[model samples]
Target: MTPEHWLNIATHGLALEAAARVRAEYLAHLEDALEAGESAEAVLREWGDPHTANRELSKAHLTTREARYLPAGYAPTWAGLGRALGEDAVPLLLFALTALAELRSGETAITLALLLAIVAAALLRWLVLSRQMLAARGRATLYWLLSFPTVLMAMSCAVLASRGAEGWHEAGRLLWERGWTGLLIVAYLLYHFSRLLTALSAARKAEAQL
Candidate 1:
C-alpha cells in the first residue's frame, strides 16, 4: 500500500492531533528506511498489516469517542469545567426531577435527603474525573461505584423475572404507582449504565497503553 493509504487506515478513528503525531513518526521511519537503500515495498511489508497496526494503535491511544470523556486540561482553562458540567448535566437534572416528584407525594424528609445525596455524589464524581489525573484502575473503580445503582436495579429485575407471572405483576404495579417518577429514575440509571460501559472500554484501552 502507498504510505498515505496505509496511514489513513492505521490512524483511522484517532483524533486529528494524535493521527498527525503517528503519521509524522511513521513517515520519519519510512524515510530513514529509504535512505538506507531499503525498497519501499520491503519497508511497508516489514510494517505488517495495516488493519493489525490500526487495532494496536487504537488500543494504545484514545479514539475520537473515548477522547470525549477526557478532561480538557491540555491548557488549563475554564473550558474544562464547562465540559465536565455538560457531561453530567443530564443525569443531575433527571435526578432532581425525580426527587421533586417524590417530594410532591409526601415523602418530604426522605426525598430531600436523597436529592442532597445524589447532588453531592455527582459533584464529587465530577470533581474527581475532571480535576484528578487518576490511574486506569482508579477510573474504573470510580465508574463502577457510580454504576452500582444500575447494577442493583438489574439484579432486582432479574429476581423479579425469575418469579414468573407474579413477579411481572408486581413490577407492573410498581411502575404504574410511581408513574413518571419511575421513568425518570430509570432514565437516569440507564444513562449512568451507559457511561459505566464506556468508561470500562476506555479504561481497558488506557491500561493497554500503560
Candidate 2:
C-alpha cells in the first residue's frame, strides 16, 4: 500500500471512528435538545446535520467487507433479519421515531401517519428488533400484538370502500372526496401544496412558539 493506500485506509479508519464520534455527538445534541425542552423538530434539526457528516466518508470508498459484516454475495436469512432487529439500538430508534412523531405532531392526518408508522415500527420491533434484543423475554407476545396493526390497517383499507360502518364510511368518504383519478391528474400540484402546507405550518409554528 502506497501513501494513497495508507492514506485511504488510515483515512477510512479515522472516518469510521469519527463517524461513530459524530453520531454520538448527534445523539447527544438531540438529547440536549430534549433535555432543554426543545421540540422534536429541534432534535430533527440537530440530527439532520450528521448526513453531511456521512458525506465525509466520500474521502475514500470502503470495500464491501469493510462496510458490512458479510463480504460478498451473502444472502440474508430470517435469522439474520431477526437478529439484526433484536438489538438494543434498533429498538431505541424505533422508539425514537415513534416518540418523535408522537411528540412533534398530534393531529388527524399527521397522527394517523405516525400511528401507522408506530405499527410498522412494532412490526419491525417484534419481527426485527427482538432479533437483536438479547434478553429476549416477553418478545413473542409483543411481536404477535404488533402484527395486529398491520392486519388492522390492511383490513381497514380493504373494507373501507365496502362497508357502511363508521371507519369504512370515513375511508370511503375520504377516498371519494380526494378522487384518486383527479389526484393523478394534479399530482405535482397536490404534492407541492401538501409540502408547502407542511413546511409553512412548521415554520409558522416554530416562529410563533419561539
Candidate 3:
C-alpha cells in the first residue's frame, strides 16, 4: 500500500496532534524504505497493519503527560509561554520560591534577577519546543526574540570581567546597584536575536536549494 493509505488508516482514531507525529514518522520511514530500493508493498508488509499500529501508538500517546505539556503545533506567544511553564513546571516553581524569598528579604536586585532568569528560561524553552511546529520564518523570529536577553548576559559577563581584582569587584557591585545587570539582560536578548536571524538566513538558503 502507499504511505498515505497506511497513514490514513493508522491515524484514523488518533487525535490530531498524535496523528501528525505518527504521520511524519511514517513518512520518514517510507522515504528510507524507498531509498533502499524496497517496494511500497514490501514496506507495507514490514510495517504491519495500519489499524494495529495506530492502536499501539495511540496507547502510548494517551498514557504520556508530555502531550499535555507541549503537544506539537504552533501557538501564539502567550500560549507558548503557557506550554513552557507546563513543560518546566517544577523548576519554575522552585525559582518562584527563591524569588519570593529574595523579595521578602528586601533583595530587590536578586528578585528581579530571578524573574528575568525565569523569563529567559521561558523564552528558551518555548523556542526549543515549538520550533519544529513553526515555519522557518517563525522559528527565526522566536530565536531572534531570544537573542536579545542572551546578548545582555554576555555583555554583563564581559563588563564584570574587564579589569583587575579591584575593578572586577567594583564592576560587579556596579552591575546590581547601578542596574547594569538589567543592561546585561538586554544585551543577552539582542545576541539571541542576531543568532536567530543568522539561522533564518541559513534556512532560507537551504530552502532555496531545495
Highest lDDT: give the candidate number: 1
Q: Arrange candidates by lDDT, highest first: which order?
A: 1, 3, 2
Instruction: Please provide, for model 1 over 1-210, each residue's C-alpha lDDT reduced to its tens digit, 9 standing for 90 to 100.
Output: 798899899999986766888899999999999999998898889888999999999877768887665433321345644654454566557756777787757765644554455455545556676656687757666645643364346456777889988998988788778989878876887887676677667767656655
Model 2: lDDT of residue 119: 48
In TM-score terms, candidate 3 sits at 0.33
RMSD (Å) of each candidate, 1 decimal = 6.3, 20.5, 12.4
lDDT of 2 by residue, 1-210 (tens): 222232333334332544444345555765777798987665555444433534554333332222332111111465644443343344445645665767755644534554455546544654444344422223332343344333344445656546558766675566568888646635754653454344333333223322
Tell how far residue 58 is off in model 2, in angstroms.
Answer: 46
Local accuracy of candidate 3 as per-residue lDDT tens digits, 1-210: 677888898777654656677788888988998999998899899889988987786555432332222224336578777876565566557757877777767766744664566567666757575556666556555544443345345545665667557777876566578586768755766765666655555445334323
Global local distance difference test of model 2? 0.44
Clashes of each: 0, 10, 18
TM-score of each: 0.60, 0.22, 0.33
- Stretches of candidate 2 exceeding 4 Å from the true structure: 1-79, 82-98, 104-164, 181-210
* TM-score winner: 1
Enumerate residue pairs that collide in model 1. none
For model 1, where is the 10-residue window of minimal lDDT? 69-78
lDDT agreement with native, every candidate: 0.69, 0.44, 0.62
